[model samples]
Target: EDQVTQSPEALRLQEGESSSLNCSYTVSGLRGLFWYRQDPGKGPEFLFTLYSAGEEKEKERLKATLTKKESFLHITAPKPEDSATYLCAGREKGGGNKLTFGTGTQLKVEL
Candidate 1:
């Protein structure tokens, strides 16, 4: 079975503050990892897809990085618009499109 754990289940930050969210995972055979951002009452929005350790993706104020056992989402100088729930999911090799996900990290940015 594949499992994912996310730290700091919720976070509150002032505008322009920076922080990082963590996602730890254990899988039978890791194939890829994904990151997403979600708003209240809405589906997740795709942020990045990391296929191997040392891989990274970035957009605006967010950056996603992957490793063998964990992934990190770094938020730099966040704004109120950046407030949202960030999620990470992992796909195992031969799992056939099945992805295991962590609960999520709820981030609130105040001006």
Candidate 2:
């Protein structure tokens, strides 16, 4: 079974709109939860990493928070440039470097 899952298969928003994206995961000995942003035809750009429940990170208009079995990416007043697919992956202790990724959340911010 997939260890990681993200909700809201797709999202459409106007510039300056705010929203939150959810990521749910089930992992034993979870080492960390990672977030990345991917633009069309481009590789994922690393965003943040959560090491434990209650850990949070922020960059510009994006904020990521984690819990024992879930994570959340909060977007505050997103702009058009923020449009992309957000992906989440999990790393388990002693599970090697390989990570299982979620299907990803597609976000489109229009003018």
Error of 2 at 6 (Å): 0.4
Off by over 4 Å in 2: none
Candidate 2, which ten residues in sequence have the lowest lDDT sum? 91-100
Q: Candidate 1, clashing residue pairs?
A: none
lDDT of 2 by residue, 2-52 (tens): 489899999999999899999999866778899999999999999999997
Off by over 4 Å in 1: none
Could you give the C-alpha RMSD of every candidate to the true structure, in order shown? 0.9, 1.0
lDDT of candidate 1 over 1-111, digit per residue (tens): 789889889999999999999999997787889898999999999889999899999999999998888999999999999999999998877836888899999999999
Q: What Cα-based lDDT does every candidate model obtain?
A: 0.92, 0.92
Backbone clashes per model, in order?
A: 0, 0
RMSD of 1: 0.9
Most TM-score-accurate candidate: 1
